[model samples]
Target: MLQSVELASTSADVLIMAAAVSDWKPSDVSQQKIKKDG
Candidate 1:
């Protein structure tokens, strides 16, 4: 993501950053997809 932003900024006349900042980080992330039971 940082690389993309850097490359874009070089050619862009005006760079408008509209990305949101996360206040918190997740403690754990699942490696596999969780199955949902209906």
Candidate 2:
């Protein structure tokens, strides 16, 4: 499973039950970047 969230000012709670959780998050995301080229 994969999940993405804008962690600006939010709290998160995770529950663990005999499973592995691999979290991969970018260090920083550009706020003003061009997404397409034409």
lDDT, candidate 1, 1-38, per-residue tens: 99989987998799886745685566898899979999
TM for candidate 1 is 0.41
Instruction: Give the candidate number with the greatest lDDT.
Output: 1
Residue-level lDDT of model 2, residues 1-38, one tens digit each, is 32434353246575433534545566787789848978
> What do the candidate models score in CA lDDT, each in turn?
0.82, 0.52
Could you estimate the TM-score for every candidate? Answer: 0.41, 0.22
Worst 10 residues of 2 by lDDT: 1-10
Instruction: Give residue 6's lDDT in candidate 1 (0 to 100).
Output: 97
RMSD of 2: 13.8
